[model samples]
Target chain A: MKLYSYWRSSCSWRVRIALNLKGLPYEYVPVHLVKDGGQQNSDAYRAINPMRTVPTLEVTEGGRVHRLAQSMAILEYLEERHPSPALLPAEPFLRARCRMLSEMVNSGIQPLQNLAVLQRIKAELKGDDKAWCAYWIDRGLAAFQEVALETGGTYCLGDTVSFADVFLVPQLYGARRFGVDLQPYPLLTRIEAACANLPAFQAAHADRQPDAVPA
Target chain B: MKLYSYWRSSCSWRVRIALNLKGLPYEYVPVHLVKDGGQQNSDAYRAINPMRTVPTLEVTEGGRVHRLAQSMAILEYLEERHPSPALLPAEPFLRARCRMLSEMVNSGIQPLQNLAVLQRIKAELKGDDKAWCAYWIDRGLAAFQEVALETGGTYCLGDTVSFADVFLVPQLYGARRFGVDLQPYPLLTRIEAACANLPAFQAAHADRQPDAVPA
Candidate 1:
């Protein structure tokens, strides 16, 4: 397996954590998002992922290589293909709650705060991009805190580190990067701290990635 | 099962289609997103869905009523509980492709063009929200067109209608609603036309809903 990833990408970070959690070894192919006008936009990379997004996982099965995109989908694929140390809850309702938390971040928060959207904020809207990112992040995290408080024990959906936790840690990194205050989200902060101590989360931290640049 | 929905919400439309495709009987409880500063923000609805989003599915299992928010999560739970007439492909790779397409719309396009985000764009950026919505819709649909072409036949995936089709139809409805030109996306339009012919898609369309207002 090989992953085309950008070190600082939140979506890329989510896939990395899932791979580490599942103990799946994959070669990392860095597709730098910042350097050279974003390598992901190149024709070669676009051939690999039509969306021109980072973290396309190339999985080889039955002598066929399948390249998959979208972080949540990739995570689900990982969970399905590698079931041990399951990233989703076995029960139906609990699974729904976990996925709901993941989608809250995936659909609600991340897209609004992504780099492409930020660039659009500046180029198209003539707006302050950081403020835009921070606004959505702050709103999303506050809402997430409520859900976390309701369902959480040690992670986002009880003691087990489900896909919700896998998804949250990266978004929290993104939140801090956008200068959103984490102080208001106590449950989220607590969960983030707990996840921070885990080796899988540690291994997938943006700053710890092979292609990470000095800040 | 009961679903809290808004007639024009694309996310709500997706859930409605999924329920129909799965042949599940669900009571439609309309939550008007545009009336009196949005009914979803009310304390009563917020008690049901903290995110205050449309298409919250309330399911009764083992005598416990579980209110599930997030359309994708709700769809997944429905698939899990009702395995026949599967919305996802049987193969893992095919499933990933279908899910990738779904997330591309869910996170990539839909969030950026949602009512709340458009309202923020208007209030915070003082930009034309319609244009902002159109820009993201055009970009995402263009990319989605490329993917659909790669993996499509009669539907977004193939002859069988999967969750990808379920997700795509509503987003296309949203794209047209936002005044996005669908001329460039022949595959998407073709698939949309195919999906439109299905009773499930027709049943779930915004205009056909109980709360639908005449154009």
Candidate 2:
């Protein structure tokens, strides 16, 4: 497997964490989102992922290659293909809850603040991109905190690391980068602290990636 | 089971289609998103789903009730609990493709044009909300069409009505609402026409819902 990723992309980070959690080794092929007019938009990259997004997992199975995009889709595929050391709860309802919380971050938060959207806000709308990102991040994290309060223990789903935690940790990293005040989301911060102690989460942190540069 | 939904919400409509497809009986409890300052914001509704989003599936099982939010999560749960009449492809790679296509609409298109985000664009950034919606819808749909060209057949994946089709139909409805020119996306429109012929798609149309008021 080869992962085409940008070091600081939260979506890419989510997949990195999942791969580590599943203990699946994959070659990291960086797609610089900000360098040279965003390499993700290059014709070559677009051929691999028509969406021109990062974290496209190129997998070879039975000598047939499949390149998959969309972080939630990639995560779900990982969970399905490599079920052991499960990232979701075994119970049906719990699994649903895990996915629900993950989507809270996935669809609800990340999309609004991604590079393309922010560029549109700046170039087309002439809006303050920072304020736009901060608004969505704060709103999303607050809601995530409210829901996590009911479902969380040491992790987002009661002492076990699940997809909820996978989604949350990267989003919190994004929240900080956007300068959104994380002070209001104690539950989420607590869960982040807990996840920070783990080797997988640590390994997946953006700064540790080969392509990461100094901020 | 009961579904908390608004007639025109694409996310809610996606879940409605999935429920209908699986032939699962669910009472439609409308949560008029635009009336009474959005009933989804009501304390009662927020208690059910702290994210305060529509398409919250309230289910009763073994004398316990579970309220699940996020349309994708609900669809996956329904698939897990009732595997027959599957909304996902059987093979893992195909399933991943189905989900990747679904997310092209779910997180990619829908989130950028939803009411809350549009309201923010209008109120906060003082931008033309309609233009914002059109821009995203066009960009997302173009990408969807590009990928669907490779993967789609009679449906999004070779005559099978998977989650990809469930997501695409509602989004095309939304695109037309936003005045997007659909001529460029012949492949997607073709698939939409195929999906429209299905009874499940007809039952899940926004105008067909009980809360729907004529445009």
Candidate 3:
């Protein structure tokens, strides 16, 4: 198995955490997203993943090169494929709650603040960088803060670190990186802190990655 | 079973389609998103769905009601809870493929152009309405077009309609509503045609709902 990833990508970090949690070993194949006009867009990489997104995992078994995209989907695949340590709850409604929280971050918060969307807001729409980003980041975070208050106990969903935590840790990492005042979101902050102590999350931190750049 | 839905909501449409596909009898409980500053924001509705999103299916089995949110999660629950007329394939990789395609629209396309996001972009951020809608819709459709071409034969995941088509139908409906051209995405259009032909999909059409607004 080989993962096509960029060390700093939140999506990649989500997958890394899942792999570590499941105790799966796979070769890390770094695809520098920003170097040389993004290796993701290259014809070579496009041939691998038509979507040209980071964290496309190739499973050699079943004689299939599965180009799995979407962080949440990939996490589900990993949890199902390697079911020793379940990342999601076994119950139905509990699973729904876990996925709901995960989607709140994955679908709700992440996409608007992504690199491509930010760039388009600047170059195509001619918006200011600092203000535009602050606008989107805060907008996404505000609603998330409200939702976080509901299911957030220790982790995003519950005391157990399910798929929601796997998704949340990365978004918080990105939110902090962008200078969003997370102090307003105490539940999210608390959730992040509890998640920070987990070894699975600690191992998947972007800074600890082999390809991470020194600050 | 009772579904809290707004006719025009893609999220609501997703569950509506799933209910039809699974042959589950459900009562439609409309929650108007636009009237009186959004009915979903009400305390009563919030009690129903903490996130306050549309398509909250209240499953009343043996006289107990359980509130479920998030279209994908709800769809998954329906698939698991009702084994007959399975929405997902038995095989893992194919299941992953169905999920990936579903997320491609759910996490990728749908969120960006959701009613709440668009309202924020236009009414809050003071964006040009036409440009704002065009930007997000076109970018998402373009990506979906590429993926649809690969994973599609007659339908999104081939002959049998999967959850991906359930997601894709609503998205294409929104794209067309925003006047985003579909000529560039023949595969998506083709898949949409197949979906439109299905009574499960046609019955779930926003216009066919009791609360539907006249076109």
Candidate 4:
């Protein structure tokens, strides 16, 4: 498998974590989000992902290649293909809880604070990008904390690590980038701390990725 | 089961369609998004859904009520409990295709054009909410059309009224509400028309809801 990834993309980061958890090795192909008017918008990359986004996984098996987009979908695909070390709980309600938490970040928070959104805010609306991002992050974090308090323990869905954790780790990184004060979210911060200890999570950190820029 | 729904919320509409498709009956509890300063944000409604969002499905089974927020999660919960008329295909790859199309709308389109997002754009940036919504909707629709061209037949994902259709119909409603010219995307409009003809989809239309006010 080959993953088209960017260093700081939360969506790409989520897919990387899932791949690590499933112990699936993949070639990381960097699609720089910043250089040359965004490489993702290039004709070649757009052909691969019409969404023109990061984290397009090209999976080759039995001499056929399946190019998948959308991080959550990719995570589910991985789980279906490799069921062991399951990223979701076996029970229905429990699995729903995990997906709810993941969507809270994926749809609720990430889209509102995506780089393209911020750039549009800055360019067209004359808005403070950081403040715009922080506001939504704060709202999403409050909701995440409420849900986490109910279902979380060492992870977003009790003792096991699930897709919720895959999403949470990167979102926390984004929240901080936008200067959201994490002090208000005890469960979220605690869960992030717990996830940080896992080797799978650690390996997928932004700084550890092949495309990471030198500080 | 009870669904906390508003007349025209895209997210709520998606859940309504899912419940209708599975032939599950539910009480409609109206949480008006525009009445009396948004009923969804009211303290009472917040207790049911901390996200303060519409279409929170309160499922009562075995004397316990499970209040599920996030439409996708609720759909999955319904699918798991009532598995006969499957919302997803049996093949993992086909299921992934369905999910990818669903997420393209769920995360890709809905969040970007949500009411709260438009309000934020208007208040903080003095931007035209309609234009802002239309722009994002256009971008998402273009991507949705590309994916649908590959997998769509009578419905998105090759004749199965899968989760892709569940998400696509409501999103098309939203797109039209924002004045998006759907003529550019033939496949999307065709799929929308096909899905609209289904009894399940018709029953879930925003205009058919109890809370809908006749213009």
Every candidate's TM-score, chain A alone? 0.98, 0.98, 0.93, 0.98
Q: How would you encode candidate 1's per-residue C-alpha lDDT over B36-88 as one tens digit per residue?
A: 89999999999998898998998887898889999999989989989889999
- Selected candidate, larger lDDT, 3 vs 4: 4
Off by over 4 Å in 3: A128-153, B61-64
Tens-digit lDDT string for candidate 2 (A78-106): 99999989999999999999999999888
In candidate 4, list every pair of residues with a backbone clash: none
Candidate 2: what is its chain A TM-score? 0.98
TM-scores for all candidates? 0.98, 0.99, 0.93, 0.98
Docking class of 2: high
- Displacement of the residue B120 alpha carbon in candidate 3, Å: 2.7
iRMS values in order, in angstroms? 0.6, 0.7, 2.1, 0.9
**On residues B1-215, what C-alpha lDDT tens digit does candidate 3 reach at each position?**
99999999998999999899989889999999999899999999977876678989888767767777788888888988987788887778778878888887787777777777777567655676666666677877787677767668888777888888888888888888888888888898888898888899989999999999867
Candidate 1 regions off by >4 Å? Answer: none
DockQ of model 4, rounded to 2 decimals: 0.84
Q: What's the candidate order when arranged by decreasing lDDT?
A: 2, 1, 4, 3
Q: Write the per-residue lDDT of candidate 4 for residues A123-148, one digit (tens) a residue.
A: 98899999999999999989988988
Worst 10 residues of 1 chain A by lDDT: A141-150
